[model samples]
Target: MNKLDLKVLDKQEDFFIINGKEFNIGFTNAEKERSFNRNTEEGIKELNSLKEEFGANEVIYLKQIHSDKILNYIENGKSIKDEEADAIITKEKGIIIGVFTADCVPIILVDEEKKVAAAIHSGWRGTYESITFKTIEKMKKEFSINVKNLKAYIGPHIRKCCYEVSEELKLKFIEKKTEIKKEDLFCGRNLNLEVCILDDLKKAGIQDENINSIDLCTYCSEDVKLHSYRKSQGSYGRMFSFIILR
Candidate 1:
């Protein structure tokens, strides 16, 4: 039920890049009120616009849970119900995998040769749980994706500037061997969850160069665009980081 405060990154446009493909990335500002309304026809309309921008039939969406589970599309006409997983993957061509996030990091994975892609919503819980690692592991095991050949983009989310945590959380990161310093733990009382996650990804084998981080701080700038839960008192609109195999 927690969501992000909708604030746009004026300098940051919605774009993604395939590992080796020339096809450009497309993004949606789900923070728009119309995009978040579950019962409103306008919500569906907004999705339709996304379809036009990124091909409607090719998109794949996941029901995100804070857990590390990952699902693959069967390429059938089944209802895309909310599944209790943090990530979704597919080998089906033209299917754009979608991951929702506010303050949590939204990650998109793509392997050009295999024509496979994945979307992961990595929250603090997921970071501690290593959901991103698990998703990469699944991609390697199920799709034969070579970790070295894979590429990932860390989308907009809460950064260390405003993401404060407790001593317990900081200890948790240390216990996990995160490379962040104790001083970088924002509020001086807690840990920087986002940095912890980035470190975890490196530990999990995501090459430093292969990773692209937007480096946006959601809580500091709440009035511009997009949504931030920490700044907006539990808003629901979510920005999407999605990718399709073309």
Candidate 2:
């Protein structure tokens, strides 16, 4: 199989498209519109447009809690409520699986053979909890995918340059045995969250060549195309990462 090609779609929305699939992922500004708050109706509408554009049928997703729990999306011909989970997987084509993020990492996995896909939200909690690996393991077990055949993508989020974590959060990750080398742990002033998640992916058996971990710093992007919880403080917006097998 060829290496996966990752492309940016709707940069204004911080949206992305995987080359071989029929789904899309993007971000939204919650502070700008009251209706767009917390993956609101407006955001869903934008996502639906992408689905329709790609000729997808149904959408599936999770209400991310930054935990390791992964849900399977069963097609019911309706939008799924944001249930508490960090990851969601599905084999049903046309079911869009979405996950919301601000600074946290958004992960997508696809099995070319089985036609199964996943959308995962990984924050420090989910990273320390190893949600990414857990999700991959679950997919492999359920879909019988060879680890090498699975393709992965890590979307734009907070980087080490701006993701500041107190000593407490750092210690928590260290306790979980996540390899946060001292150099990558603190970038003069902030913790490098990208490093933590990247290391986790490698540990989970994803080859380095198969992952497209964008280096875009949401906090420092002068264009303001993507949302940054750190840059905007607590009043920031959100970006949605979704995928559907088609």
Candidate 3:
């Protein structure tokens, strides 16, 4: 199936080898025209199929408001239904956690040693609030996850190639992330969310070598099948990216 084509986290050692290179983390494409938004019949069916595809009972997600609010699956009694958060952290196994994204970053973090994992949705607002960094801090506090042993997978999203922002927004972002050089953060008025995310991850004490990113840009990648909100002008649907401690 096209969903298995990317093999997104195959290069990483965080996943268990359940069935021959099978991964616990996954990033899905727009194959079969699936949206996984859960607001319609097709979306509900697609989301359930994803549960089957990942061999998990359910997929936990958030009613993302682009804020830095993070949730703990266990604290919610090991199950959540549309929690108001941007990131989810879980230390349990076999229960999938995920986020929906279009032209926004979908980040999966794992502590292989401790069997803890997290799924984060980071857009421009989330980025400004240091959502990725805060998620790591929460994981550390909740699960005692060591940043050095944490592996991160940054899935495809709108990069600087097709993510030009307004001058005021750019200035606000620049004002917040003063550690990164302006030239490195921006490509001539096009804000690079990847760069911003990288800085956040690094600042959170995650080693650079443990961080991996899909080079494809959702909004501009010619050959990639991932969806893009800006490219579709918000007319289409979002792709789901998830991870589990399987």
Q: Write the per-residue lDDT of candidate 1 for residues 1-246, one digit (tens) a residue.
A: 111122322233443333346233444443334343233476445555666766647555666768877787768856464556778887766665677677888877777777788888888888788788788888888899877777776777887766777678767766765456656644565456666666656766877777766655666654345567878788666666677676
lDDT, model 1, position 97: 68
What TM-score does structure 1 among the candidates reach?
A: 0.81
Q: Give the runs in model 1 whose Cα sits over 4 Å from its true position.
A: 1-24, 30-41, 77-79, 178-187, 222-224
Question: Which lDDT values do the candidates have, in the order given?
Answer: 0.65, 0.67, 0.78
TM-score against truth, every candidate: 0.81, 0.83, 0.89
Candidate 2 RMSD to the correct structure = 3.8
Per-residue lDDT value at 158 in model 2: 79
Best-performing candidate as measured by TM-score: 3
Residues 59-95, candidate 3: write the lDDT tens digits. 7787888999999887448456666888998886777
Q: Which candidate is the best by lDDT?
A: 3
Error of 3 at 98 (Å): 0.2
